[model samples]
Target: MDLLALETPCLILDRGKLEKNISNMHKRMKTLGVNLRPHGKTAKNIDVLKMALEDQAGGITVSTLKEAEYYFSHNIIDIVYAVGIAPVKLDRVVALIKKGARIALILDSVEQVKFVAAKGQEYDVEIPVFIELDCDGHRSGVTLDDSLLLDIGNLLHNEEGVILNGVLTHAGESYNCKSVGEIRDMAETERAMAVKCSELLRKNGLPCPIVSVGSTPTANFAEDLTGVTEVRAGVFVFNDLVMAGLGVCDESDLALSVLTSIIGHQKRKRWVITDAGWMALSRDRGTASQKVDQGAGLVCNVEGQPLNDLIVSSTNQEHGIISNRMEKDIDWDSFEIGSMVRILPNHACATGAMYDRYYITDGSTDIIDIWYRINGW
Candidate 1:
C-alpha cells in the first residue's frame, strides 16, 4: 500500500532518505576519527535504532530509562542515559544494569555524586557515572573551572560502589549559531573544554577514560576531533526545519513528515483547514528565533515538496490553518477537500512523539512496515 492507503494524521519515515542520512553522518564522523553514538530520542522505533547500530559498534545515547530499557532489551549493550538521572529512577537503572547492559548516567553536581554513591552502596550495585562539564553555559552542566567536575570525580572515585567513567557535554548554544562556520568553531571549543576537563581529571589521577561531546549542529560542522572520543547526535538522523535553517542539511534530507488531509476551508478567513494540528505536528516553534520563523510547519504538497506561497500559519488542538506567508489573499477554491499534504515539522523530536507508529515507506514509497514506538517514563 502507498502513503494514500495509510490512515490520515499519521507519521511516515522515508527509508531511502533515512539511510542516506545515516550513511552521510557515519562517513563524516568516521573521517574525524570519533565514535558515533547516535541519540535514540529522535526515532525511538526499534527498527531505526537497529539501522543506526548496523554500521558502528552499536553504542547509543538515550534520554530516559524507558528508552534505555527498550534498546537494551533488543541487545544494545553499551548505552548511556544522557540526561541527568534523578534518584527516583535509580531502581530502573539498577535493573537495566543487572540485565547485562553497561549503562552510564550523567551527573553535574557533587550532590548527585553523593546521591549515586549512597544509592550504589544501598543497592550494592556498581553504577558507572559520568560528570557533565559546561562547555558553553548553554544548558545543564558544571563549569570546568569550578573544580566541581574533579570534586565529583574524586568523590565517586573514593566511594565504595560508584565508578567515575569520564566526562560528557552538549554544546546547546551551537543551535543559535549564525552559520555552519560558526558551528564548526563552536564544536572545536566545546570539544576542547571537554578534553581539557578530562585531562584535568587525569592529572589528578582520576583515570578519566571516556570523553564524550554531542550536539547536532556541532556534529555536522565539526572537522576536528583531536581530543574528542565520541559524538552523540540524534537530530542528524532526521533533519528538521531547525537543522535546515542552520544549513546543516537540505530540505530533501528530512526523513519524517506528518501526512495531513485537507478537511475544510474558509474563503473569508483566507485559510485552509487540515486534519493535522498541534497534535499531529506538535507545538514546538523551533524556528521562532531563526531568520524566517516557521509558525507551525512548512506546508508541502503531496509529493513532499514545499508548496508555493503556503505555510501553516496557525494550529489548534486538532486543526491547522494554512495560508500564504504574506498578507495576500488566497483562492480557497483551488484547495479542494480530500487533498493530502505533508507538513515538515519544526522539531523532529517533538513531532515524532505526536504519533504512535510510523508508516514505513519503502523505496517504492509504499507503506511496507509499521514500526511502533513506546512512550511514557
Candidate 2:
C-alpha cells in the first residue's frame, strides 16, 4: 500500500492538505456570516465532498444533474444546480424534487423562465428557482439593471407551480485577479451585486431572501458578507494553481496532482517527456496574463512540492514538455526514463475531470489509495 510503489500516471490527493483547505474555508465562511455551499464540481469525489460538507448543514452546488444524483444518493441534500437547467433535464429535476431534495435551478432569460414555469406546471410541482444575475457579465447571467429580473420574478411569483427563491451570482472574474487584495475587491463586488439585485426584487414586490455568491478566489479574500445569505465556492475544497496564483491558498495546500513518469529525454532539447499530457493534466492554460505563466501546470516533486525552477512548459495530447527556467542549465539526464513526478494543474475542475479516479495519499508519498470519480454527462 505504499504510494511510491503505486503505478504511474495516477491522481494523488493529500489527506492533510485537503482537510486544511476544508477547515480554512469553513472558518472563513463562518467569519463572513454566510452559508458555505461548497461547489462539488472540483473534487466530485465522495471522500472530498464529505470533508467539504462538515458542519455546513449539508448544502452543495453542482454543475450537472448527474452530480446532483450522485451527491443526493449519498444523502447530501439542499443542492443547487449552478448551471442553467435546460428543458431537456426538467424530468430529472422533477424526480429529485419529488424525493424531498431541496433543489433550485438558475434562470437568466424570459424565454427560459417561461419554459421552466410551463414545465413545472405540467409536472405539477413547485420548482424553487434562482435568477442568475450578471455581476460583471463574465459569462452566463442576466445584467443587474436588466428589466428581466422584475419581469421574470413577477411571472414566476404569480405562477402556481414556480417559486422565485433568490438571486445568485458567480464572480468568475475573480479568477483573473493578480493579488489577494484584488480578489478581495472582487468578493465585495460580488456581494454588492447579490445584495443590489435582491433589493431590486424587493422594490418590485418580490420576496427575495437568498443572495448567493461563489468563486474560490473571492471566497478566500472576501472580508464582508453584510447582505449575502450563502456562499458557494468549489475549488476551495482542493486548492489548485489557479487559486494559488491569486494567493487564495499556498502552493503547498494543493491536494490534487497528475502523477507521471519520465517517458523519454531529449538531452539536446534540455527537456524530458512524461506519460502525462493534456489527457492527464488539462488544457486549461489558466490566466497567462499573470506574473507567472504555468504552461499546463507547475512541475512538482513526487512528494507534491513545486520544483521552483521547473514548469510543465508545454503540453500536447498525451505528452508534456518539462523544462527549467534556463533550459541550457536544465539537467535532462537527472530525470531518466521511468522517474516519477507530479504536476500541479492550473484549473483543478478541468484537470480533475480528465481522470476517472484519485490516488489518495496521507502525504507520505509512499502509501496511496484510489478514490474513483464520476464522469460523463
In candidate 1, what are the lDDT values of residues 189-287, reduced to their tens digit? 999999999899999999778999988899988878888889999988889999998988987888889999999988788889999999999999988
lDDT (Cα atoms) of all candidates against the true structure: 0.87, 0.85
lDDT of 2 at 330: 65
lDDT of candidate 2 vs native?
Answer: 0.85
Q: Write the per-residue lDDT of candidate 2 for residues 1-377, one digit (tens) a residue.
A: 86667677778888888889999988998888888888888887778888888764678999988899998888887999999878899989999989988889998888888888888889899999999988877998888777888888888798777899999999998888777788888889899988999998998889988899988888888889998999998988788887777778788899888889889987788888998888888788884777778888888878777788788888888889898856655665567688888999888889889888887788877555678889766
* TM-score of model number 1: 0.97
Indicate which candidate wins on lDDT.
1
- What stretches of model 2 exceed 4 Å from their correct place? none
In model 2, where is the ten-residue run with the lowest total lDDT? 325-334
Candidate 1 segments exceeding 4 Å error? 55-57, 331-334, 363-365
Query: Residue 79 of model 1: what lDDT?
Result: 95
